[model samples]
Target chain A: MNARAIDVRGLNKSFGDRHVVRDVSIAVDTGRITGFLGPNGSGKTTTLRLLCGLLTPDSGEGTVLGMDFRARGDAIKRQTGYMTQKFSLYEDMTLEENLAFVARVHGLDNRRERVEDTLHRLGLFDRRQQLAGALSGGWKQRLALAAATLHQPRLLLLDEPTAGVDPKARREFWDEIHTLAAEGLTVLVSTHYMDEAERCHDIGYILYGRLIARGTADAIIRDSGLVTFLGEGPGIDRAAHLLARADGVLSASAFGAAVHVSGLKREALEAALVPWRKEPFRWSEVPPSLEDVFIQLMGRERDERYTS
Target chain B: MTGSLPRILAVLLKEFTQLRRDRITYAMILVMPVMQLLIFGYAINMDPRHLPAAVLSHDTSTVADSVVAALERTGYVDVRYLPRSDEELDQLIRRGQVMLGITIPPDFTRRLLKGERPQILAEADASDPQAAAGALAAVSVLPTEALRHERLGLGAPRSTAPAFEVVVHRRYNPESRSPFHIVPGLLGIILSMTLVMMTAMAVTRERERGTMETLLSTPATPAEIMVGKLTPYVVVGLVQTVVVLGMARVLFSVPMARTPAGWLALACGIVLFIVGNLSLGYLISTLARSQLQAMQMSMFYMLPSIFLSGFAFPFLGLPPWARVLGEIIPVTHFLRIVRGALLKDQVLADMGNDLLALGLFVLAVAGAALGRSRTTLD
Candidate 1:
């Protein structure tokens, strides 16, 4: 297998007059988990679909799984698995039936054995006869995971797979994803949660169909060049609201009872905090967090929009 | 609970906005009833006209010619065919190109001039017994009715009893039972019901329940997905066919096919009709964006089929426009093919045109469906 399981270049898609995904390109190294983080409708889903050959790009072309993805879509589809943003297994069908159907659609041999193995591995065997609709949100996600992966796809694309799942179930799902990646399956997952982004081996942050930042979590935070000040005082929430409009302050928000103010100019941020530098309010410069960096990125985009 | 009225109203208003977003389905729901009312009200006629008939005249007498003319004057029957022999007449009625057949005996004029009773044979295809009843009754009185005319020089000289006799023959259903007609028609309706409704929901249900994205992501070709979706329905259609055919036979004692060829034709027709209907439903599934829309469209197709395919009314009685609409629907042709093969014991050659038409219906619908089923999410 090639080192890059997913290698695609310059992809574009539009629905009618509105362009949804434009001049986009992405590649995933084999056995790596790439987290996609963006606000909703940033074309994360659209790009994933384009990469998987589900939606045709208007102008770009590349290869997926070493095959010409656009021309040999069926071949690429045979080796790739996609889990949708919503739980998409048939609600009327039982869990066992859903897996078996996927297997049959993929034309896999020993379908019964494969279904049994999938159910047993996922610990969903007891609920094999239960309808997918009857399962809870977490269980439904797990079932969808099982159904998508039954064909032993070389690449897996998950769109917000843990959105409604509980923390415990979410951790377990992540653990399973990691386990599969370790077994040489390349995975690209989209999520909005900070903790989930931290768990990914690499991260890509998109804004308005444009990929603005991409690196490991640490690399992105360091490359952001953002300086944050921690303010814990009696009225930090009020201070945060005031600081948000101050010059050189990129973003200001109350994190729990503390106020987090981040900016590119550390001296200017300190100068702006002169009025609140008092006995009750203690301000200390700290390293920027992933969340703080993301906020700064969004603020930078807003700033550019205002200036333009 | 009473205090929640405003909140309930808020949700209701939001729901209305959502409903409006589904513009096609909402518009269709409003349009369906009015279209059905107009088509059924103005177009369906229980009393059919221009019932096609054929003539075989072995007698070259004026009496025989006048008798044939009298049958047409009844306004119920139109002589569309001049058969060379009994064989050709049988072929015409069996194929349902003509519903009524008149066979004048060679010795009818000779016997009538000698003051001896002679029979003028009139054959009516009784598969749809009611369709032929009005015309058959009129043909049975043709000899006396023709003789009563003073314009006929030779026939007027003889008394009413002196004229030749007319004998009526009811083919297909010897007793003219209603079930014989109804049972065969039910086959067409039942096939349309199960095949169209079931296949219509197949893909739309996937989309509504959010499974379409996952389904499309897989390596399965659109053709594979469609065939997999339709295979189970084909089996269901077969079981339905057997059940309906068995019940029709046991309950109504509908006549069985006289030859293996007729049975083969019936089998081919049922399979074609079922497959054709499934393809049509698949086309609808691709067109509709929601399961509700699919159901509405299915009903939109079915109502016209039931009304215009001669299920509840005589097909010949319908106006030309309604008949043209009926011709496009697969059920109408399947109805004729099934009834002809089972009731009239028509072979493939007899119902060839109908079978060919059904094939065309399948190809058109299936081709459109495949074209629409591109893997893109457009």
Candidate 2:
């Protein structure tokens, strides 16, 4: 069997009286992409930091690339490349200069050749002389990706790498990530976009510092056991509000000109939609989507953790 | 550690390249001290000559002429105008036209002939009371001229003799060459100011740019990083010391009686002390959130050092409480050591206490900085 690229268990962290991460565990296979999906401040970034040795957990036992996470942090750091959410490059320097600085910092041999190759691979060779600050968001994202991969680390830990990137740019970024994964680079990326999460081999959904669900996109949707019905009409906003207050309705949210109503009990969801069926609104029972399952999961979890 | 050598060298090279790009910093590093030396070297004058004075001769006789000649002979005073009226003399003193105004009464020649003692009126500007005191002593010498003629029996009656005598002794800086006093202290201020400001800002800039974290994650330990950052500034400090000392010799003619090697060694020690102070500043920068706050804190420390370090003012003349406060500053001890070695040709034995104080300060500050850098948080 191939060794796991990341294997960690029973991770916990607390800041003052608040537990930021609680008993979280996850594993990603070698050369596979795993998505960490959550809302803001949902322990996703903290977990990523813990995995990459950027932060030490209060109580945890984990091995990253066969090295102990706590004791061999330096070794782990040397073998992993972390790209932070913010644009953390020297803004005054040109694109080529920024990349060359990272290369030299890593003490990589053939630095000039490596920098040329990385820039060319990112399709940024034409704009190599442009100052980093002057580049558009898309080009800046490309530069960050190139700098992250210049050292060729085995594992890549990315924290919300596509937060402010446009849809087209984000799609291109995901394509490049997949290409890197195909070359046997293990990637663990956290993202808020559902489409980005769907592209992952497996997904972990965290809420309020707790892992609520984990599986493939299809399995997470299937195993959630939620029955969702869509109501299409001109006045769906009132219907969504009324259905949200209705009995047995797990979650109701608007999704692009349609209101998707979901409940764990199929009969109850159908009964809740029965009142809206007499008007111009049309209700159709459909298979639950990943968004529906996640919304229902989020509805079931508390907004904050309670300690007894 | 061996594998990280190339990486450390790369970081050093990158820092140097970035420093080169910052032309303002380059100019500050190279030009500021020389300009300060040239300007301040001329501005500070301890030995002042050619003070303006007014002479009032109530008797226009040879004795009064002799008195005027005596005052002119001293070369310390320049008799600007002989006022015809005493009110004019008072006006000259009030307007600051003359710092000293002397009056010879009409009975001055008759008093000398009758053997009655006559007092000469000498009024002076007492704003800078010390300046007036020096002028007063100089004016008293004029009466000695009259006595000298009487003793020689050439131009004065033999019956007239001076009843009392006055003697003057100048203290502290006898020759009053400003450079002798200023250059030694300027060396301390220049080294501390440049080293602390530059190193503090440089370290803070790295942290601000997120490069410090990159360096931390490397195989280089905190100690290695600190040493690498400090080494270049030490070299710069040594070069500045040499330039300042050379300028003092060429322009101000300040002499150094000790061997060149001894001076160099002392300067190296001072530079080390400065580097240690700058390292402490870097530790402060790490705690600060912005460049402005770092600069403010540096200035806060620098202002007191300039005032209390005995560089601009005499440490001994300060009040007891001020002196006690001044002793806490490293620059205070550094100024004392530099001036003692350069001016007095003081050997290490004579400066054992100052050397010990500087050594302890360096170790304490360097250790604190290293300790602070070891922890990730402020």
Candidate 3:
């Protein structure tokens, strides 16, 4: 078997005049969970859709599940599961009915047993008779996940699976994702949350229809070349706005009582922090976080857009 | 292919569940056909009676008075106006006050007594030909009846053959009942409007509800999706057929196919016509982006089908181009099959062209619908 569940190159997709996914290439290994982080309309969802057979690329050449994806879309679709950003299951159907539908669509032999097992495993058995539309936001997503994975697909693609979900529910959802990945199911998920990015085995940050930074969370932060400083004082949080507009400051923001300022050059960052470095204020060089690196990356892309 | 049946069943069950949950679709399915049947069956009349007419008689003789009296006994014309001149009668007819006019000349009684064969001119407003046909036919038989009555008093021999006699045999509908003509055609029309609109909204509803993306992401093929989604609706269409046909039989007393073979032919035609309409609606769903757009598109299709497909008008009466256009609509061929099998007792063997046309329509429209259906979001 191939080590990668998905191996694709030069995947291009466009809607009318807007080129949404531009020359994107990605490779995801089996049994690993990969997270995609990007701003809205950055092609993260489009790239996820293209990997599965949910969308046809304008121009692409790749093999998904050891077969040519474009030529053998039906074959690829059978092995792939996609959960849309929205609650895509039939809102009018009961939870049990939705899972049964997915199971039957995949032609599972033990449809009832599988639906029962999934409902119980997801802790949704108690409310299986309720209409899916009546479920809370977190439960709706959990049901969506249950339906997507009901067929035991080799690869699972989730688009913003927890947008409006609470922190506890999101954590539980990630725990379930990790448990599935440990059993050798490949997952590619997209989200706007930084904590979710930290939970992934690998991360890809997209900007303006292009995948710009890709690595483990720690490695991406290290490779971003962003130097960050922590400043703490009585009113140091107010200096975030002033330092954000400085020459070398890429991003400056207040985190409760302390303010974090990041830049590419250490001297430039230190020089920008000079005003708040007086009397009671204490300054220390700290490691750049994933969010700080992503913010810097977005600022860099914005500068590139203006200059070019 | 092995998984096709299961996938189709999955879609069929899902559609059924949603339909059961939707109260609006249930109301539409039951109420729309019966309401339209009542409105069209009871309210509209193609053959009218007791039409208003104007009579102007210049001769005040007994012969002229008896002729005028003979016109009213036909039950078609009601002589309500006694205009003084031709211009007054013309004004009454032109302004839509009266439908017919009768004028007696000055020398009518003298000419009739001398065997001059004087003419009593009868004029009709022929703008609505259906309304005028019965009234004018009544006037034509008047001369013979009145002359036969006059011969008894004049003492003339009744052995000689009078003028020409017209013997018309109106087959199937001797009484010219409007319901007999309209009810069978209503079957075609009701199926076209409801089946097309229902199926057209099927796929678009998924798209609008954002479930289409998830559906496309599954292992289901386009063929599987189409077959699965359409099967439940096919049952619905069949039930509607039974409803409309039952109402036609019980309420309107419309005749049905006589022999077993003829009934089979009707059944086959009905199935083909339902599938054809469902396929056309699926094709519209592929073209439309929303349920509203699907409804609008179904309406756009229904207008031409109702007008050009011999449902509301006579098929042969249309212009050549319109007749050619009517031949393309599935309702046209289906109407022919229905009217033939029910009223004329035509079997499958007798209606080869119409059945073949309906069969070809199903194949062509189903092929187009499947071709246009997308397996992917693109």
Candidate 4:
């Protein structure tokens, strides 16, 4: 049986008069890699921060790692590791020194061995003496991850962990994350990339400080009630702009030679594309992708935010 | 040809918007100069008056009373204490309670009547030579003024020489070297400037550079972080103190504490003072959002510390309100402790009040810093 690592409810956070996280309730199972997906300023980072004791909820009660997150923040912080979106290590210190500082902060025994093991595990041992600030973006992110997990935390919170990394580095970073999760270390990561989201065991979609969707990637897309039609033909991609304004067509965008048009009603979406159903244009019904569902959710919630 | 004018306007407009948003820098720019002008103009009295004095009179005669009255009438010396003995008078001077001490010898009246040119001794605390210079010069005209006093007309014919000579002794800096007074006090000012600014930028630097978020996420408490950051700077402050003290001794020939216990007291005072400033800097770091803001805040603090701490002027020369402000400043107490130990050879027991003040400052500022330090980003 998979134990619950994070079971939090009614999490609310506000900055000044702006409510950044509103009534966010989430639960993550142990050893699961849960991805938080949202647009900019949609409280994914804030919710992750609230769970890992980096920020206190305006009003929330939860148990993280089987302890009260609010009352046992110090204990939670010790057992939990947090990697911020920005590289937050000491730039002036060497990579080894950065990892060693983290090891010492958590008061780990045999600190030298831990630092050396983490450096080698991250493949940074060769460049251990390089200043963190002097390293490139990929190396810096790798060092930050090594430092975050140096204390062997059971729970990891990564905020946009692979934001600006190259594709190869991002793949390696994900592989390392999976290796850690296989060790029964629960991970909570926030990312904007749909490919990264698909790699997670489950996903949480946040919009306007509210968790509007939560489930596995397949389940979320299945429950979105969105219909999509992919069109293929000469100049059929140009029809996306016109179909996007048609009745009941929520989002329409071209993907190279093909165009994916999504909406709630299949008949209305098909009617919106009726103008391009000529010899040069051929359409087929397709399962709405995760990106299609998210675009629909973002549009629906943003409209609600303004109208309400 | 003038296309760049709008771009210049855009940059100027953006600059003003940012400046308006930074309330601390805005207030510093607007409020600092006015406050400094008012303080420097009204509180800094170079030729000060009503200096506290002590009179130890062995002569129980009308002439001694008239002589004390004459000195008081000069509007420079205020004879506030009548100590019973010379040792008590000397203690008052060393304690910094009195700026001047007068001694009326025995048979002062008889010596004046017999044309013996009796000597009335006047001793001034010359640590602040500026404060003592005017008051000491006032003693020179006392003999002529005493004879002119209608109440005690000594009915002596005017002669080439005055009847009695008022012998003046400038204690501590006998040569009235300004460097002796300035250098030791410079130690306090320099430590206040550097230690406070250095540690003041400590937490803010981390915050500005985005490292504070990771640091706070660890199991380290605010107290641990504060101590870990400031303890190193304490060593730095001590090394700075040794360098400045060595320079003061070797270069300026400034007298240091004679006894080893006195040196120990000075060292203790220095440590307490350094810790107090570092704690104050930590408190500023917790309050400031940016390193620039932290620097501005430290500069704001250092102005009052340098001006009102009696490093730039005599402590007694300031008005009562300014002295009250000076008393609250840690530098003021440290300056007194330093000047007293180095100049008067005072030991630990003699500097109890100032040391206690520094201890209280350290406690209060460190406590405030810990209180202000945020464990969470909120």
The residue pairs in collision within model 1 are: B48-B317
DockQ of candidates 1 onward, in order?
0.76, 0.13, 0.62, 0.87
**Candidate 1 — which residues are off by over 4 angstroms?**
A110-117, A125-129, B1-19, B62-65, B113-117, B147-152, B155-162
| Weakest 10 consecutive residues of candidate 2 chain A by summed lDDT | A299-308
In the predicted model 4, the residue pairs found to clash are: none
What's the TM-score of candidate 4 when only chain A is evaluated? 0.97
- TM-score, cand. 2: 0.72
Which tens-of-lDDT digit does each residue in B1-378 have in candidate 4? 599999999999999999999998999998899989989898888887888888888987766577778888998888889998988998899889899998999898777777788899999999989888977877877877775553236665556567788888999989999988999999999999999999999999999999999999999998999999999999999999999999999999999999999999999999999999999999999999898999999999988888888899888878889999999999999999999999988889788999999999999999999999978888
lDDT preference between candidates 2 and 3, better one: 3
Better of 3 and 4 by lDDT: 4
Candidate 2 clash pair list? none
Each prediction's TM-score versus the true structure: 0.94, 0.72, 0.78, 0.96
- Evaluate model 1: give its TM-score: 0.94
Tens digits of per-residue lDDT for model 2 on A167-226? 999999999999999999999999988999999998999888888899899999989988
Model 3: CAPRI class: medium
Candidate 2 per-residue lDDT, tens place, B1-378, comes to 999999999999999998787664565456646644643454333443456778898975676566666777876677788899988886676444566788878877667655566777777654334455556667776655645664355434554346323333222234556677688678888887888877777667877776554455444556777887888888888888888888988998766638765576476457656766777677766655567656656766676577666677555334456567777788887766676566545456555667777777778877877777741211
Report the candidate with higher lDDT, 1 versus 4: 4
Query: Per-prediction count of colliding residue pairs?
Result: 1, 0, 0, 0
**Candidate 1 chain A least-lDDT 10 residues:** A296-305
- Model 3 lDDT tens row, A1-308: 99988888899999999999888888889998899999999999889888887788999898888889889988888888788999999999999999989998899998999999999989999999999999999999999999988988899999999999999999999999999999999999999999899999999888888889888999999888889999898888988898899988889999999999999998887788777778889999899989999988998998898999
lDDT-based ranking? 4, 1, 3, 2
**Could you tell me which 10 consecutive residues in candidate 2 chain B have the lowest summed lDDT?**
B163-172
The Cα error of candidate 2 at residue B359, in Å, is 3.3
